[model samples]
Target: MISSCFVTAIQVLILFTLSSPCVRASTFTGSMFEVQISTKLPVKDWVKEAKKDSDPFSLWDPTCFKFVSAIKSVDNQLKEALYTCHSVPGGDENTRLKIYLFIPPERLAPEKQEPCLRAAYKKAFDDWKAGVSANFQIRPEQVQFSCELSV
Candidate 1:
């Protein structure tokens, strides 16, 4: 017994409530280094647990330590590296992973740090494979790195 106008109004309200999170505008301040990983492993969950979680420092284990250590060793003055990761959608593999490394300005510049960053990621990959089971292994070529300025 509801009128069409009432049904339309309710639908609009429901749509707005569901889409509000995506409608908000936010800015990222810092440099963003992307680590693109293509693998069959459950990288999405691993990244969510290791980097995207609120208390990653507490959740991280030796693999995280080795990864961060390798990144820090890229430069003596390098101090900050914040991470956020997500799985790329509609990929051919089990998952295509993107790890965002955010660092403040006047610290690490993308152009100057890319090569070292690649090496660091390679080392991290090796450490990760060594620590995990055979099923979780990823090859060196499966990981790629790129850097960009945060807008």
Candidate 2:
């Protein structure tokens, strides 16, 4: 029979080995902008409702060629946005949907170029909110933007 102390030591070793990758992964950092959407409905349902609308860019200011060109320029500069959703703690009957826009270190835009991208993102988000508000039971005011940059 295995001794209790031996079993405990083996468990500890397994745990340490299993956790090493997580520790190493945390050490690697990058630049990202996060947009959080707070809603009363399930996140998947909310997103589906939101996506039902036509593309925001196509609807927002199609008459202005300059604006469309600017948005396309901004889009070309950034990476694809990643989305994640989860339930809020404490049984609040709310969901938190996070959108992550990852900017590679080499592709990071200068300070002067940020406002254009931010405005485009904000408008797109606003359009989405307006389109999905009725179906998702969320208001435009509940979205929040946070930025994290690793220099």
Candidate 3:
């Protein structure tokens, strides 16, 4: 009973509603970054200085603490996102290493961080949001630093 012109007009209105500014999408990007630097001291002084979730001087010579020479853009100035694990098989594993979570500032304080996070680093995706719920599957080798969806 509806004419073709009326149907076309209704379709146009529906299309406009879906394409309005109120429905704009969020813009953000995330990536898993690994900071790798070697210690030259015979006893690994740099590692001793580096603290978990604590960013320490990249190179140390006793007086002035410095950031990494090559690091340019880091959102986490305090570098408080690093976690250290000694479960690796090496006996001296605890002596010479550090780990850090590099989350971009644009991706920080999101209503939903994970939904906006890189698919590869889903462990941080769900938790970044305030009340979001989801599951995460972390590999056993990376369990110490990852989130498990079930628990």
TM-scores, one per candidate: 0.37, 0.36, 0.19
Badly placed stretches (over 4 Å) of model 1 are: 1-28, 42-80, 105-107, 110-135, 148-151
| lDDT by residue for model 2 (1-151), tens | 0010011101111111222455322212233333344644443443454455465432322222212232233333332332211222335544443223333333334343465655664565455445344333457566444443333
RMSD of each: 15.7, 17.1, 21.2
Local error of candidate 1 at residue 132 (angstroms): 9.4
TM-score, candidate 1, is 0.37
Candidate 1 residue lDDT tens string, 1-151: 0010011101111112222456543344444444444655553465556665454431443233334444444433333544534345644653443433334443343344566664664465444333322334556456555543232
lDDT of 3 at 79: 35
Clashes of 1: 0
lDDT by residue (1-151, candidate 3, tens digit) is: 0010011101111111232466444322222222212222233454455443143332222111222221122232323442221111225322122222334433432343454343423433222211111111222222122221110
Candidate number with the higher TM-score (2 or 3): 2
Q: Which window of 10 residues has the lowest lDDT sum in candidate 3?
A: 1-10
**Candidate 3 Cα misplacement greater than 4 A, ranges:** 1-73, 76-114, 117-150
The collision pairs in model 1 are none
Rank the models by lDDT, top first: 1, 2, 3
N/CA/C clash count, model 3 = 4
Residue 34 in model 3: shift from native, Å? Answer: 13
